[model samples]
Target: MASSKKSVFAAFTTMEIVLMAMLATANAVMTTYISPINQALNTLGGPIATSSITGIYMIYGLLAYYIIRKPGTAVITYGIGGVVQAFMGTAYGIASCFVAAACYMVIAELVFAIVRYRKWNLGVLMIAGGAMVPIWFFFAANMFHYTKWGTSILLIALGVRIVSGILLCGLLTQVLGSALIRTQLLRRFAISRGQGA
Candidate 1:
């Protein structure tokens, strides 16, 4: 038990913790700015427009995981982001922020776990990102009465969200991670330690 505790503690170094905190704070602030855009999209194109950008909401957590390459990276990042969002306030309410965070964390961790946390390719990251959407989508559908939109529309929204997750969350994470690595800013992270950019 003592060894297990130590191992868990060692999983996150001080630098990792600091980076996660910064990313979480960024996530909260970005959500605040993005919320207005999402609201506008909801008004103009309904669920489809908002769904197309849903991936952006989940990117910070994925980027954290990508950089840290650790078991709980995404979970910790999302959890902190949820807490920060609660304090910062959200259009969807504090509870919804947490729910969305939980959903993203669970799916991302599951996807990474399935790969034994050994893969960091674009395909794997895309799979993780795209997989994170459906659970929250269904939950939000029920909570927001989107079920009344008919099965075809619901499926379309879901599809758009998945693709958005692939491109915006996963692909963009790789892009940003690579960019950071190129700048040598992430030299201390696992990704820069010969883990491949």
Candidate 2:
């Protein structure tokens, strides 16, 4: 007999959507509130400029993916995060949100797919999050005039993004996720399901 267990889904369940929404919304609020601080950091120039706080934006999506362990979770979570951020109002406006959502989600999904979604370990998660930066930079270059910064500065920004991805999205997310698992709050989700908790 075939096992009842199945792989990731193309579509999410209602519960999954709700979970994603909550996480994404919280992330948006945090991100929006911190925008000014990050902008001020940008004035300082070099890697510190772009690397200041934006990495935290990746938190919700990374955590959602950890819990859901599903194919489209990253996209839906991050996309909703972008919508939430836009609705909450930001200096970058809605267009930036849409572009960011699209770019980050696409790259995140691709990286997750490449790993076959079998690995939820730190390094894999870091790679998935880091993968998003190139597309982020691509769109940001167009949307924010990164070209004016010169190649060296742009490269530094890229390094900052990758480092942030690993630290904020990967490491911090992993630590938080493990804590959530221990709380048994996620018992009904994929993470717990996998753990047989």
- The candidate scoring highest on TM-score is 1
Once model 1 is optimally superposed onto the true structure by TM-score, how far is the C-alpha of residue 133 displaced, in angstroms? 0.4
With candidate 1 superimposed using the best TM-score fit, by how many Å does residue 140's alpha carbon deviate from the native? Answer: 0.9
C-alpha positional error of residue 82 in candidate 2 after TM-score superposition, expressed in Å: 1.9
Task: Compose the digit string of candidate 1's lDDT tens values, residues 1-197.
Answer: 79744543356889999999999999899989998899899999998888999889999999999999888887899999999999999888788888899999999999987876668989988998899999999889887889999999999999999999999999999999989999999988888975532
Q: What is the C-alpha lDDT of each candidate?
A: 0.89, 0.79
lDDT of 2 by residue, 86-146 (tens): 8888787789888888887887788777877777888887777677777877888878787
The superposed Cα distance between candidate 2 and the true structure at residue 43, in angstroms, equals 3.0
Clashes of each: 0, 0
Q: Which stretches of candidate 2 lie over 4 Å from their true place?
A: 1-5, 195-197
The residue pairs in collision within model 2 are none
What's the true lDDT of residue 180 in model 1? Answer: 95
Off by over 4 Å in 1: 1-10
